[model samples]
Target: PVHDDDDDDDDALITDAITGKRYRALRHEEAESLSDHLLSLWMRAGPGRGAELPVDSYKESVLEAVRASQVVVMVVITGCGKTTRIPRFLLEGQVRRVRRAECNILVTQPRRISAVSVAHRVAQEMGPALRHCVGYQVRLESRPPERSGGALLFLTVGVLLRKLQSNPGLQGISHVIVDEVHERDVNTDLLLALLLSSIKNNPDLRVLLMSATGDTQRLSQYFGGCPVVHVPGFMHPVQARFLEEVLTEMGRPTPPRRDREEEKEVAPDLDLVADVIDHIHSNREPGKDAFRADRRGRAGRCQPGHSYHLFPRKQLDRMAVFPVPEILRTPLESVIIQAKIHCPHSKAVDFLAQVLDSPDSQVVRVAVKSLMDIGVLDAAENLTPLGERVACMSCDPRLGKALVLSALFSCVLPVLSVAACLTRDPFYNSMQNRALVSKAKAALSGSSCSDHLVFSRVVQSWKELQGRESKQEFLDQYTLSGASLRFIHGLMQQFGENLCEAGLLDASAECLRLSSGLNQHSQQEQLVKAVLIAGLYPHLIQVKRGTVTKGGRYRPENLSYRTESGPVLLHRSSANRGNPDLSSRWLTFFSAVKSNGQVFIRDSSVVHPLALLLLTDCDLSERGNARPNHSVLLPGHSLIRWEFSPHVWELLWDLRTSLQAMIHRSLRRCDRRSTSGGCKDSELVALLVELLNNTDPEPGSDQEEFSTENIRSDRL
Candidate 1:
């Protein structure tokens, strides 16, 4: 039931009208007699009976092209049936012989939902025995209960890259169909480059670059003019309208505009969308006056008496047809890790330069620097033991770091929930079910403005209600995605297993369960927040106050924050968006991006100034080499004058160092017996627990912000 807007296929599940029984399409059976009834059903239900797709005509050409060349460029639009049908064509085309080579066709998709959906469609067509033959492998989940051996395997682009780490030559895969190459995402580009290199050694390995809007000539040239196959798609006609025309037809007067500075402080008027929809329904006609508008300028009529045709002579582009390559748009921590493991000898920047359409040099540099800050990569750009483990996780490098630290602190359950939520599709719809989802989330969140904690509660409630009610009913009541919930659960279990392997938790404790001795830390709010800091440090924003105006009427005073770009308000969907009293002076945000001409923080959590210092990378001045007024200087010369003196700062530093050592020792113990008893209930944990529990702020300190000035300067 999880639908991706990117997929345009109109195929629905087949059902019998008389019996109301749903059935899969008849599949080819190797050892069966084709009776008259079975033959009639096959003829009626198979692909040939429906309006023949363009790919059906090109099956011979496609197979011949694969036999002739090592690479092929397939430029087919959406709904051409290329994604689901072409793979089966290749698989079934194999000649039955005494010695059949392992000919597994690997089709890689850009999104997980696409891979799972396409695999299900292919499985249904392949019939029951072939149910195991057509399967998908995505992060945290795999169908058919096996790692490999699916005749036609569908997986995400990132998963394929991870596979390359183990089998750089892609040993068993015969043909790799890189779908949506037009996206030019970081994973797809990296994967294509690696495959091209592998094809030189293994010429038998076939590559197919498929896209709806790709530059065929460019791709063909990249493969040394590989054969290009064109498959025409069924296109749908759409109606278009400009905003100004819609407003005129609806008889809504335009509001006066303001200066650029005033515009930055105003929120978008979303009510206009509903008004346009209502007008379209109330006034739409068949032939005449359907979309006609008055031809008028602000001062005078544009054409005196004639009605202006609203449709443009040329089609107007609504949004960018292609995606911005992820290197430019997203954090590159995970990509950096992959680069190190796959291209070991080359530095991250050097290896990335060899990729097709490499990201900007500064962007790569910033990514490497961020990884170093998080202790994933050392000063020499080597993977630490922590980095080795983090690379195995299927999430952002920072979130992986958070999970590791949470395990060390014996608070893995909630942190696992937070980590899983970050790497999956959102639990609720902010557009249609915003108010209801928000009210439920707020009730669970209590006084915490941390979106991570709020989501943890939401997921925990869903878990508690799992058996009492059906999953679909629970999802309907909460307006959540069932697939996303399953994805989160899969990741939580995956994290627990990985933590056990890394010796961060007791071997006996499975799936988010902590040792009994360490269970008390799971209940502490400050400890969980501190673990989040270890992962999401340096992405901090200083909260500021501003005012927002809408239509010159609803001008409300607003509290906003500052990113490198400019001032940004929180998304209305955020738990902390309009609430200023929930520890809102400063916060750490997940991402800051511009949408609808205004920048906004997607998700954020508040951190106390002291907690920030304890969690971040800091060093105390040596006794002999002290700064004036006992100041503790962070990176970039952001100095913090100690509330007490040098000695108090030194004591706090020593205590933190001891706690880190204690955690490391606990993680290094290999035997379950050694990990089960002493370390979990040690006096060190008790002391650290007491320290985190203290909430009283230092009375006379004048520090107003905890800034990552050093981090920013290093990136520059």
Candidate 2:
């Protein structure tokens, strides 16, 4: 609940004489009265803006639609004031009718950049005095409204979903405006489902969905055919030219038609684009020439401009009108966990079925199986203690679990850095200087055989630099983007705060105590790799050694690897791609992408066999007719196998059991309340740390010279 400092006996109230109901609506009336006065002053002081937008003309209609219906779908075009003005209209419309304390309005955007930029624009339009009423919130950053109610907030869809997890009723919020509904991303789709459920129990809540290019009829029907208002855009006429016209204008003859076999030999898209640019530059005036090619219709009419069509009209017509809903295309693990958190009694599949476009049943089942396999969900399909902690975070379930383990292992800093890096690419891969960037990354990796570690080292090195100029030099040297590094830094701080909120870290020390033993064995790079193995398990890859020449020379690129999917090579951008030898035969990766008919695994790191045995999900069985005592098999992967002596296997099994038990107990404690004292040291953690330290053999040591025959493969 928001704290109301003005709640006093002297505060004003409104009385409904007919119904005898005492309404606390006078505060909103006074606030609006003052707001109007300030807005008038602001207008007189400066040039008026936003009054000429197409949406401004329909403000009264929009307000009337909201007043008459439970839902309103505004089909406004781009460059209209719907995104900025509608929320204000709704808030002002509730001036004397609803209590000021209950007039909270939330507007959601599809992306963080859009949310923040729109919020800033709205604030500027509201003027300096009234700007406090408008603000925005996104992941890791926010400038929320200063007052409790009678204020508008712009936020991303994901942030709103997190709010729903804690406040299912959406207590004080009176209106929710979901912008860009046409995009139909996973978060927006889930939010719509949850909002529908919320509206059933809360009659005071109103929803306004605004989209420029969405299917208005379908959206109106989805909201039970409440009301639809269309606002025309303020479009300027654009001069459009097709490709044939462009070639005619350039006085260039069309090339002869090619057979199917020769089509692949056609000039590349970039080369054609370059040629077009050169032609335009040669023909256009010195300073007034501007040529724009846009895929979206709205972009061409933002102002009076010329639009060049690069492709044929038939090709444009054949393209899909709208994108597929993300819920159907992407994995549903996060969606399932969020649904389970919000609706505990309902099954994940049943809850997801209510979404606008629910995913396939098989996809849902696969996600559930994955959650259960990772110990996030149990047999009954309920969130476990670990799952509850993972739910509090805004990252993937696997990455979230890795964060929790990092806290337990007292290595929060390094793990947080790696997790933040995984969210997006931080390094700048310049097309012209690709070789230079790759060489710099390899140098930073320094035999670590870890692309993830390279990111952490970059951040650490940047922090160590004393001055701004030095930091800039360091970034330039490594071809890193300053903005991206700052984003990662902000994410690290935000994730640390999340850890504190989840009770994984002590809030009092602000993560300082979480690193109590920085100089200890837990701080070793190998332990960080262990945590990565725990999170990115099942993404394991088995390294296939390349043949060595008589002179002991081998090409690192010849080293092929196998995943659950067939053979894949190391991505060229990986730090480990250039290393001649790796510390272990098994490696864990962040993800794999297929390009040009070849699959490449990226952001990889070598993991000790012991880390795989203890951290990953695998089954151990006795070898029936082999000299090896026990054989390890990953549950779903049949191509990979590991063998060890019986004595070694028994020790590993016992250690794994103990580690699991300790982690469960620790997570339960975190769930109960914030652990201000931080994670207590345990003998099991110390033992595991020591074991991990010993697993990584020193360079040139005898332990690093194991023969290739020890690794058995069915394919071989």
Estimate, for each residue in 199-298, the C-alpha lDDT of model 2 and write its tens digit: 8877888899988886778878877887888888776665667666777787877555555444433444565566777876787554333544443354
Question: Least lDDT summed over 10 consecutive residues: which range in candidate 2?
Answer: 11-20
Cα lDDT listed for each candidate: 0.64, 0.72
Q: Which structure among the candidates has the greatest TM-score? A: 2
Q: RMSD of candidate 1 to the true fold?
A: 11.2
**Per-model TM values vs. the true structure:** 0.74, 0.84
Best lDDT goes to which candidate? Answer: 2
- TM-score for candidate 1: 0.74
Q: Model 1 lDDT vs. the true structure?
A: 0.64
TM-score of 2: 0.84
